[model samples]
Target chain A: MTTKPWDLKQCIKNYSAKGIHGITIWRNVLEGQNLRDARTMLDDYNMEVVSVARGGFFPSVEEKKRQAAMDDNLWAINQAFLVRAPVLVLVCGADGRQPLEKSREQIKEGIIRILPEAKAAGVKLAIEPLHPMYAGDRSAINTLAQANQMAEEINSDFVGVAVDVYHLWWDNNLQQEILRCGKNGNLLAFHVCDWNVPTKDFLNDRGLMGDGCIDVPQIRGWVEDAGFSGYNEVEIFSHKYWATEQKEYLEKIKNAYLKFT
Target chain B: MTTKPWDLKQCIKNYSAKGIHGITIWRNVLEGQNLRDARTMLDDYNMEVVSVARGGFFPSVEEKKRQAAMDDNLWAINQAFLVRAPVLVLVCGADGRQPLEKSREQIKEGIIRILPEAKAAGVKLAIEPLHPMYAGDRSAINTLAQANQMAEEINSDFVGVAVDVYHLWWDNNLQQEILRCGKNGNLLAFHVCDWNVPTKDFLNDRGLMGDGCIDVPQIRGWVEDAGFSGYNEVEIFSHKYWATEQKEYLEKIKNAYLKFT
Candidate 1:
């Protein structure tokens, strides 16, 4: 298990040596590191890049700002290429400044704008459908079926969906969608996290894999059976884990993946 | 629109006079006034009780207490009858001290045990499927599909389901399930509440309809289209509402239901 105190280099090194596949990173981690420097860092550790942090939150009211959002997304796609990552995860933007239909249209238009850049950069953009809890301010794409609907409409090889267990565990159509995404070649990335029973805080109470009650293995089985063999990326948003030493958090992550994945 | 400190009498009185069809009660309100007295009070108010507070939490390893639980459920069913409520709402029991399968079997058995008593008392038992978040502790029946599965297994016209907006709002197949439940004549009660953004507390913090972002009228349209004609029973579980006077709460209920329902 990778320990929490480990930096990116140590994480990749340990993960690679242990036959653990790769790691997904947060945007802030790359804020100071230059794209070239980050690329070199991955090369030095002999680690694979599963995905870049993210690039989508498309909805915007001002037509002027919509261009800026698309420009930012282009930059993220370029960053994913720099890291040699195949996918740049995208969150469907919320209905913040306009009606839902207008926002949905905006999001669709924004995605179409980015598709050319994504294809040129050789990076597939993964449409990450957040739980409906985030439907108002986070993402309008709130279900796998909805995400797939957008993906089909776009009809691009560069666009797909990331199947995150934390956001999708409760979905009744999860298994069916997995098979559909798999058949349509829409399953771009796989992320794992547990849903705590009490789920104290909406944004921060995410559990470590196998620590909470979600049937993680069952979901993994469904994804695997559907032909998704990507990295089972761990992404817990636990305040408890955040408060602990990074080394311990990493160790728990490694152990949980081994146990639950 | 319902205000804080809800008044049982005024709510019933107004509902009855307006021909606003049904009433659903919480256990605290029922027990606070004593179940028997509450039933009598409701009868005097001329409101037809739609459903009882609840009868669930069946999964427990404490075999010695199983009979006690059954007896209490029997009492709840009798109360439902006394209040002239046709349905006794039930949440599938949680897994306590036993494996998930055992707990599921036990719940089925527990429901069977109470079915005779419920039938004898002329009360229909409505199985309410809670959100998957409550699968471990609150209720195991987490999906409308799952509730329908149980209803089929229970094989009784008296056993049905309560479609609570708070719990089923995020479901992808909700429209189909509502139609299916209605088709089978299994849609006994339709409870209404909003899913607050950044839901602060699972046990409380339900938003007043139209205060939150749920498409209430859309769902209401589905239920009605599927042949449901019951009252849009408002059941807010917010500490904020509980903090005010009962009269204010009743007024809010009336206003919110009028505007949102």
Candidate 2:
């Protein structure tokens, strides 16, 4: 999670105490924990578990690794179901060993392979299209239109999209694609963050909403216009913020959310 | 250039000596030199000037800055003409102070404003759509589709698009867009570079062709299939490579170009 100092219980307690009632739980934080207890803790705090952070790294050149990824995803789906998280966000992967087209095909196939279990468990598989900067290895699906195309072809209600403003905001076609996503009832979740003018790190240098140049409020208007009345999950992956006192950072997040988005 | 250590004359001399006759000239390298002398130098080496590296930074919150940008573009067009370069690449800029749409609007307006000068100079203006990572402050046009739309709307024989594999290989729509660009007679230049898997720096960490994950030859094939018969420019911007002895670097470039593209 972006709040690097906090464990799962600390996250629930701190976020809810700060009146941030909805939280997305990264799969990493769920390690060495009982799923039922995690659910109970969420219930105790009266905090909603918005979505499971991730479940897919589905594209790999090795068949054994692909199968292993599938198995891991199944485990993640079980975790999401047990923790009462309605959505499992997937950062669909790419393989440097193969062409991106091959990676994309593998991603689709991987998702299809795991769809039945996700459906059986009642957790929507939300494909979060990553920034194209990550196209080498993080994800082959780098645009909403591509994700939309795949989701449409798959045609499963349990399969949808997670629109993170950090990733999708750069796209000129974002508003139109969001409309399309909503029209098909495929807009499953929304994540909020800013693209810093000088993004120092590709993976973990995301800015709080107003700290960067992204027109967060404008994008929020578009997403809302697309009929997504869901959590604007604060998803800032900032080394700067994470290094700071997280309580102060959490306050900053709240203020940024209120002021900017 | 990516060969940051070399000046324009050295670049022409060394590149041509290495049988890398085609060169794209960045404006900074022309600052103190007489355009006539520069042209004569290029001719002496029997080097082909493919393009002037850039011409546009047309978006700014300040009106004065926008006009200054226009003047700079005019100068760039003149330089392209004097240098006998057929094309001037435009990395149309974004203003951090405004929304991306506004920046995009200004980019189109800027190109339109400069059209007459470019036409009069007999130098085609090629819009080089940057990667989305730069959409915050570098270029609002981050996709071939956006560039195509702008070029089509501007509707000038003097206007076209530059396809850089580094900025665009991630797009699933890239092949389709290349076809469309060719059909519209808008594909003016082709630039090639590999995207390093763990790209350390956003601006200057481009890898040599076969050193990274990009399918350069495949993209080259797509460009050729789309009716583009042009030099595949090696446009790497690696700090790692630039720190090396540039003559040896040129050898590496030649090898990568041959092997990858």
Candidate 3:
């Protein structure tokens, strides 16, 4: 893998040099950075920011905090606009404080509330359905089908879903969902990661391309067959990977993408 | 937790005391002693062994090993009968040297080949759908629905599935699948374990009931509501759980179950 730190500029430069046309950014990387500077960097590297880290997590106990969450999303949308990112990923937050239907309604309203800003900014919002393990805290949208349902209910081309392998590999309806997304033209972003057996940490145990058990190539084939032409952004959260030199990690990423993905 | 080694007799004795009607035995526990001796122990305790450790894992590069694997399964069925184990849990083997689909078909056939013997022995076969991370090297069956589908194909109450929370907790359609299984009279065994955030080992590293993130009681309710009045067998494969004495571990199991499940 690449031995350098996970600097977006270096990643874009490397991606561009390697003929990769797109990249995805996490929230931490975008925080406090000069948006215009990031924009200039992306233009310089000739790379497209396919998707922003995420928004959502709308369920909160405090009403002010929930509103603040929406405001934070607005800021994220603005950042996406500045960086020319086409999609803003939303993770449906889990707060089972109310009846499930009420919670669902709240989430739908949350997404609807943010859609106009996202649309005005010319940024497509992609809802990312996480694994069920994250259903309590990270996302209530736990399947591509669920995301598609939310998107349809919201009724906007500006809202769709981003499919990541780590989250969707276990679905019996995966291929069917992919076909459905493709047919609807709702597939916005494709992220790649492995599901390590005996996944140690829910938050940081994500395997790199070939290190875990997910059949990435098969999933990629489904997406491709479904007409998804986007970046296969590698997103591993392994401690070992993070501990290593980023440059080395990048090299490994390149090799793993070629060899496994 | 129980203070001594995990003896089969103690497992039976303790199981009866707690009103938990069944036990799933591991191969080590079964193999360590004579089959008749184990049966005698269960008989003495007046406890039912719900399922035997395992069978399946049919795919192999070597033909001899593959056949031997089946032979071992037949032996397991015999043992299951001896111990009054109604079901034999299968960890469907992986691709081995063949293609994934081919291996899957081979495993299906292997199961079919064993079904007659299973039926004759009055032992139902419960196919355990492992988590997708185990799809490559463990079981090809990776979803409750898939297991149900297989059961339908087999067309027998003798063939169903063992629902392990650690494996199926991440599924988005869990509620629907559990209902499907219940409706079809295919819900067989229920195993409980927690999915820790950072699962350290694929084989071990399972959490005690409530320590991990899984909404255990919620899932338990789902199962019970779905008409499964079976064993809430606590199966923790964690190094952390094993480090303590068996007595302490048993106590933890009881507490976790009473509190969470």
Candidate 4:
């Protein structure tokens, strides 16, 4: 949410100008915008369309709600195809009303249901295990080990895992798990962001690369060593950065990326 | 901090009156109080001293700060002894200025240094692995597995793990780790608090046992099955509850305990 002030067109134009070739478009950014035009805009700005920000809130206590989530996910897969993005990142969701194990099972069920369609649409699904803090309502998958377990179980070419430094940096088993994901050929994306000390807020308040406790360069080295030579997609959700001028924030992001990542 | 409205004497009286026989005292409550009198007061109220709330912030970037922490921990072991408590819950600390790995190493070192004092005082050191959110500054150890690993590596009967539901509720490997700790005779304490759905604040927004997503009775079952027959300690740190009438709040806590725990 760093460039909250900008629309998709402006974000593309400015990001490409600042030498950010990658763009992971959230579903909200695609709202009310024509998909064809959005694809054209990225091409016009010489930007590579990284994975679509999300698709997967697969668990709900209510049967109707779970069905509804499936419908929306199908639509999201189509969105990924329309934007010419190869992957749709999954924030595999949780249901606080039920046990976490139940929600986790539902996440696997949802992914398996979407696999054939995702393969047909020529879009891969990247399961992003969020930080444990988000496990309450955001995602049931809270560790790379858990994600690797699920991906290995599914064993689908269309399925993989996205490694986000902000979420997995604190994990002692991170390097080993990254190597496992890479060895399984399921490491699809790498997202960079920092966990600010005294993280004032749970959802927002993310720090830039070098501003927080995460050793981004060290984690990046691990990922690279594991054969992940993909784009380091910057996924930061910070109210602080969004309130600032987008152009200047982009400059800071570039500097942080170079210095840390 | 549900009983923030009460001092140590008042807390003992109220808790004992409410049939809360077991009490885990935070160091803050004993700040200016005489320790011998604190033990006498507990005796008068028929309160059982479960534990001294905390000691351990072992990691600091500065060497002087680390030395100071060791001194404080030595003092805290004395506090636990004076109060006739059997265990001291440790919130093993992390330094944002250094890598988490460095902080983790420092934590192990800190525990080793305090081992002799804790053993001499007849007090077991309980390593409370905090939630991953607290991994930024509060605790380098953020999982039961990590705590279990540390405890087993220490190979001392005096060093064990404190399982706090609020910190570990979301872990997929929680039950397995708890079993491992119990099997190794490293399970020292069981703390109960819930993770509110949104978890509005990082530090203070803890929920009472039955009020949130945590399945308290189920976890208690796991603990029991693993041969842990310790007091189910009620530790809730909530600004909202603390702001209310604690007498009535204690009633609510008792009710939640009976119904959930």
Candidate 5:
């Protein structure tokens, strides 16, 4: 993820100036800033915190690391509540040292441990299934179907799934999975970004809406059909974009969002 | 993918010298060489052509291009037959300009068009499902489940699925899909490689067996359990490996094969 130069306050100001209605708060952006102040800034800008930008690296081979991850997620839930973000997106982690099954089990256990806190805070924990490419170290959950299944198993109103076109666009079962999630009232968030053809970097080469092959509008249609009336969050992690003039890049994003997304 | 250095004869000699039992031939290596002579070379080295490296980029937006792809696959089938290779691995392609569904449809049609020739030539077509990262332009078939479904729908012995660890190791349904492929007698080939942790290149940063996170032996066990006793083909495309002294790399491959794979 390459967008690190802009701080939280700057991001909120830019988003509001660009007519962007919502923002997802990455945890790093909250560092050194008071949560209450961040909330105040969001209110001043009339910007909505669609979801807190991540709260799960649950899988770890080490017992201490797993406990620490759980503790960190609890902290994230509290942050999400303070920021007035209704959903906390989770990139459930994977441990390369252990079997994926074991890592998945740990993820389940971690979520269970944090679900109570999430519910108490009225901040839904949205399990965001990452792309299969990240399955080695990023996330064990790599499919909407898997996320949907997990959410259903967890069976709480506070637990749900975030449907991201960037991660899930390639899946043939995406529509069916979206429908399934929506049927179960598990669709919590929707993130949009395109998959670049010659995706240079696995983590930061995401395309703007119209720059790549992904049919974002079609996937958005599916999401909307599945009753997701939330923000079509533009979540690009592009090194190229980050290197450009931020204001000009913001204009391009707005144009792409209006014309393509 | 890396490894563009050696010719077919050199590859065979080097592999045989390193005591590598199998080699999958890329189609480019067959150019300007007599197929009969290639077969003779294989016999001389006492090495097996595991599967012809590729033969399907069937999806294209243009009708002529699609036809050309089908023709190319037919040629690949003949090459596989000439080399005494039983299978031709297909990277069924996707067109970024079109919907994945359209690309997939074209792939199915292309396979049906070529199936009769494959059967006549006694060359099985192995539909190797690529990683989802490649779904935009390389192959719409990104899951082993999709490959298995396609193989079953085809319902011919000439058509089967190639299970590659690099593409499919992350899949939650991998074991079950392997079982399904095995039960249908459609498991044509097994390719082995590891997903590098910080995989530098999406196309070529493949790790050696023990160098990365994949539990190669465990996946091998699954393949074996599913009745696949074929060559555990060491198919890696690594920039790092290719940059090294290939002989030393070959030795590393042998060691990894014996120890981890």
Candidate 6:
């Protein structure tokens, strides 16, 4: 995980050595590095740049704050373009000071504004619907249906949905919604992680696949059935794993991926 | 709240003195107390029994555990009968070892097995759909739509759904689902609480109404429009509020109920 204390280059080498096919580059990892150097390192290690880790935090109660977020996202889009990642994941923001509906509108507006730049740069924007528990502050877009609706409304080739099992495994309508998303050609990415039963931390208590209750393979089957042939991106946020040895953790992740996903 | 150290008699006296309209009795508060005495105390205070706090934990990996859960639920039903509560709220349980569909089927089976006893005792069973965050261990029924479908399939005067704004407010289809529940004559209870923006604890960080992002009054309006005329139960689990002065907290609750609900 990014919480581990590895430098960007070291992380790429470690991932490449472990036969990890791709890496989603967090913006923080690129803070002090040159984008060209980062791209060169990825190429040297045979590590495909999956996507820029995140770009969206579009909702804000203040106009100036909203403008600042868009400005940051535009920068992230450029970074993704420079790094040769095809997509920028969006954790569309929510402002507790306003209603969720208002925050949702702000997210839509923000995405529409950024779409032209993203398309011109050949970088798609993947709208990731967070879990409902994060609806208060992290994101107002908390369901696949909502993401699909937003993508449809935007109607842009560069705007689509990212299917994360952790956020969506609990919904009864997930399969149908995934089908609709794929039917509309809006499934941009597939994220894999498990939900621990006694999930201790709201954000960082994610389980590795095969260690929790999610039927990841079943959901993967649905994604493949719906014609999504993208990377099965392993996006995990875990305090426990971050504290462990990076090598051992990467090995475990590979095993879990083979066995459970 | 039940987490408070007050016994049943004292709680009733305190609630009555505060002019609280009703109390939802938890099984723990009834320990070592005579049910007749509890009912007499409610009558003496001229307070209504809103509903028994809970009755369901019906899913288990083991058959014996499942049977034991059912037995405890049947006893809870009898207790609801003795206390003159019209409904027993069900926090339908989930087993982490199995698929969610299995846990859901087991919950349905458990409910059907107990429906006759509940009907005979004249106590309605309200399936409380928890938030998806609790789907792993608390309740597999995590949407108003799922609860509505389950209740309709069960089809009895005694089976219905409890709409909790804290759990269901993030849902975009909530109003439509509530309408469907009402149309099926399955809307039984409504619980109120706000969701703190940075919810510190998953179980006990709930905010008082108007203190968090949820529009409680909006959800209440939707419930009312869907023909639910029952008591607006103030169900909150908050470590912060529990650590504060109980009298002050109860006063705040009353004000919040009047102002927001």
> TM-score of chain A for each candidate?
0.93, 0.99, 0.93, 0.98, 0.98, 0.98
Query: Model 2 scores what on Cα lDDT?
Result: 0.91
Writing each residue's lDDT as its tens digit, candidate 2 over A166-209 gives 88888888889999999889999988888888788998999988
In order, the Cα lDDT scores of the candidates are 0.78, 0.91, 0.78, 0.92, 0.89, 0.91
- Per-residue alpha-carbon lDDT of candidate 6 for residues B87-133, written as tens digits (9 for 90 to 100): 99999999888988999999999999999999999999999999999
Candidates sorted by DockQ, descending order? 4, 6, 5, 2, 1, 3
Q: Interface RMSD values for the candidates, listed in order?
A: 4.0, 0.9, 5.3, 0.8, 0.9, 0.8
- Best DockQ among the predictions, by candidate number: 4
lDDT (Cα, tens digit) per residue for candidate 1, span B213-236? 677888899999989988778888
TM-score of chain B of each: 0.89, 0.98, 0.92, 0.98, 0.97, 0.97
Best first by TM-score, ranked: 4, 6, 2, 5, 1, 3
Model 1: native contacts recovered, as a fraction? 0.20
Put down candidate 4 lDDT per residue, B1-261, tens digits, no spaces: 458879998888888888788899999999999988898889888899999978999999999999999999999999999998999999999999898888989999999999999999999999999999888899999999999999989999999999999999888788999999999899999999888988899888899987789998888999998899989988898998999988999999999989888
Where model 4 places Cα greater than 4 Å from the true spot, the runs are none
User: What class would a CAPRI assessor give candidate 1's docking?
Assistant: acceptable
Choose 1 or 3, whichever is better by DockQ.
1
List, residue by residue over A67-154, the lDDT tens digit for candidate 1: 7888899889888888888889997777533445566677888899989988999999899989766766778777788888989899
How does each model score on TM-score? 0.87, 0.97, 0.86, 0.98, 0.96, 0.98
Docking class of 5: medium
Better of 1 and 6 by DockQ: 6
Runs in model 2 deviating more than 4 A are none
Give TM-score, chain B, model 4: 0.98
Of 3 and 5, the candidate ranking higher by DockQ: 5
Span of 10 residues, lowest total lDDT, candidate 1 chain B: B1-10
Clashing pairs in 4: B1-B236, B1-B237
**Whole-model lDDT, model 5:** 0.89
